[model samples]
Target: MAMQLPTCTGIRIRSMSDAHVIFHAVTLGILPIVSRRLDIEERRYIHSGCVCVWEERSAAGEGSSVTGIERWTDGRRWGPSRVRDEFLYYQEKLPEFEADEELSALIFGSRLIKQTYSVFVDTPTGRRKWHLGTSVRLRARARFYLTLICMAS
Candidate 1:
């Protein structure tokens, strides 16, 4: 089930079906970044297949997954320094905008807030708890984003 990854030059992932390979690639490329954070440049890299996820086996035969941008569209290898430079470049290029506190809260809130509300329950106490948890999460998230924004500024 080994196949050559077109995006990762001279590298092949062993014992992976086509579906697994594609799943890994897509997950690696998209899951880490929120959809709202994805810009045109990120979309271009994703659609052009510049991302790769490969499995590496340790000496003890335990396998681990490695995900990264192995190469650029122009076939240049993305070493650690290259990746860091690209990240810094994008960070600098981000346009300044008024940060929406509520939106930032929703984005950064814990999944526990959603799970607590998702349970099928009609008790007033349960509803109250859920609302309380949601508010706390949102407030914490707002504070976190504010700190980051302040540091960046």
Candidate 2:
């Protein structure tokens, strides 16, 4: 609903009761750096929480619906300037990801919110990718890990 997000610019999503699988698939699909290429020095964190399905939802309801919300901030800064570009690229992709029929279904169905995100980066010879995504129903743990991948191109 009325989400007063962290000062940092990011994407927010809501998933269904069993949206773990879908969310992860969608996230990994976007993480260009991770899905296509990967390297070491890579660690992704996932935090799940609940939030309102509607933009008008309340904060009281958005209590960590995100099951896997991590960041690539470190990768953005320490990696290469191209890495920062990756972050910006994915940050811009959030709306499209959320617009997917499947994503909309999971988030709206839960009545419980799911928030996940990450910042992307295109390092030199090496690349770093990180993003946080939430799934209400992580019945499958893979959903948790996969959603943490880059959510941008």
Candidate 3:
């Protein structure tokens, strides 16, 4: 049986084997964006039960990029070292993107845009509805932050 623990955005710790612990992380937003931001090619493949992401000019073409994740069910043991390395690599490289407002908004909700908007002037009922939508978004954001904080400690 494997045990898993959520660490942070896109990162987790899992025990898939008695001999090794696996660190798994899924890139946030779009893989192409992640590849560009991290200066990697936007392609993914599974090798020895571990997924690898990088640009392969030969396989694709010069100046061309492919973006996607691949999964397999061959039942090979997940290479813990490779998984851990990927987790650490992303952990080091992703902080800036994670903090970016545009990127965060892509994953989270937009802060500036109201959840609900009126086409014309706001009537009292329209205003109330807008406020309700805003409040719901605020609550969700608060909950997300709270969860992050709790996970950190």
Best by lDDT: 2
lDDT of 2 by residue, 1-153 (tens): 232222221223433323333334434443222221112232122122421111111133343332222322312112112222212211111223437888776654433123334433333322333443332333333454466664541
lDDT of 3 by residue, 1-153 (tens): 222211122212222231111111222323211121111121122111222222111233422334321221222222222223212211111123446776675544422111111112122223111000111233344666799899999
RMSD of 2: 20.0
Per-model C-alpha lDDT, please?
Answer: 0.28, 0.31, 0.24
Stronger candidate by TM-score (2 vs 3): 2
Worst 10-residue lDDT window, candidate 2: 50-59
Global lDDT of model 3 = 0.24
- Per-model TM-score versus the true fold: 0.18, 0.18, 0.15
Residue-by-residue lDDT tens digits, candidate 1, 54-135: 2211233222322212222321222222122112111111223465998654543521111001112122222111000011
In candidate 3, clashing pairs total 1
Per-model root-mean-square deviation over C-alphas: 19.9, 20.0, 22.6
Backbone clashes in model 3, listed as residue pairs: 41-55
- The collision pairs in model 1 are none
